[model samples]
Target: MGVSPQQHERESFRADLDGNVRAHALRCAPIAEALSGATRASRIYGIRRFFGYFREAAGAGWVLLGDAGHFKDPAGGRGIGDAFHQAERLADAVGDAIGSDVRLDHAVAEFGRWRYRTYAEYYGLAADLGVAGPIAGIVPRVVRGLHARGRIDGVLNLLSHRASVLDVLTPARVLGATGGHLLRAPGRRHATLGELGRLATTEIRRRNAMRKPVFQSGPAPRPVQQETPEPELSR
Candidate 1:
């Protein structure tokens, strides 16, 4: 996958079930020698972002779950885990509604709130990674520096969705790293700061936009009534 300022491109190949790996080998010749006589097969897919928000998740007796409720870029490979987490929360909400006298609709609303709270930081991180720009260049360097300092575990934990973005990439840590880089490459400091500012501004806009309501709920319309037959006239 390659992210550029204009777009993101993901390319991969798949093999047939009959163990015909020749096509993949031909397409990916760099690894052809290693793939010689390989019997396993695999598939590939592209992940894209369709960022959105829904004001309400419950209406009448129905509720949305998983991707139907929210989705983010798959670049982080957190889709499955996110879906599972949503399902667990939804189940808990449903169970409480069923076991107690609470209204299911209210429980579902609470579920949506919980989902937003849990997914907000990860969503921002995924959005940042999905787009190309200065961040693309700076983030890798930052990670490398963290690794050199033996603090890469924090980054790894963030990638694994085990820690919040702020916890891993705190403002102070980011500033310190940026300062060090600036000192080492004083000539590029201006460009780096410009890009970092743009990235931060973009993220702020995205986060605010996400909070805006994208759905509305109202009472269902009444069913239409049928006209009475003229049976009396026939009689």
Candidate 2:
């Protein structure tokens, strides 16, 4: 929900708070519903949260990788991907540090450049409408034009943990291909689960009622019984 104390102060914290408990948090900068068990559903039904990095960076005086350097909305779920990629890049620098030609300063510079660029793209994408349901008090919903802005693929590879920042561009291309399908679907612009539930509950309830008859049509076929016998002991 990205429902932070800061956001709560600014906008009266209107984000939905309907998630179920998965576990308790130990004061870390940090929900459940019926699951779809599909990739898209998995992305949606889970609660989203993100940590901001600027505060920690200002307080600490060392080079930071990841959201410590920058962060994006957990709505997109790209922060982990972004951090993982940054770590991979850092590992290369570590290797360089171990070699005769190590330049710790150069590695730090490269990391800052890469981190800022990644944050630039990430922040720009997140700022657009339709990315995080609705930004606090900007509007009732995301504008139709920006509804399908979609997740950047380099970003998703970062999310899935399958690729590093060096490999994000390829996935970015694929995300561009079908990312707008839902937005383009008739009346899907600005749609969210709350909007969908309003329209579908009646029909879904009816369907569930219809399913009951089939379920009640006598007992389902019984499983064939099987038993395991004890092994014979040696004489």
lDDT of 1 at 53: 40
Could you tell me the TM-score of candidate 1?
0.66
**In candidate 1, which residue pairs get closer than 3 Å at backbone N, Cα or C atoms, i.e. clash?**
none
Model 1 weakest 10-residue run by lDDT:
9-18
**Candidate that would win on TM-score:** 1
Best by the lDDT measure: 1
Q: After superposition, how far is residue 225 of candidate 2 from its true place, in Å?
A: 56
The residue ranges of model 2 lying beyond 4 angstroms of the native Cα positions read 1-61, 99-102, 129-235
TM-score of each: 0.66, 0.36
Local lDDT at 19 for model 1:
21
Model 2 per-residue lDDT tens digits across residues 1-235: 2223343332232232222111111133322233223122222132223233321211112367665555444545566766777788767755665443336655666665555544554443443322434442212122222234553443445446454333543333323322454445635435543444442453355446434321112222321222222322211
Question: How does each model score on lDDT?
Answer: 0.62, 0.40
Q: Looking at candidate 1, what is the lDDT of residue 175? A: 76
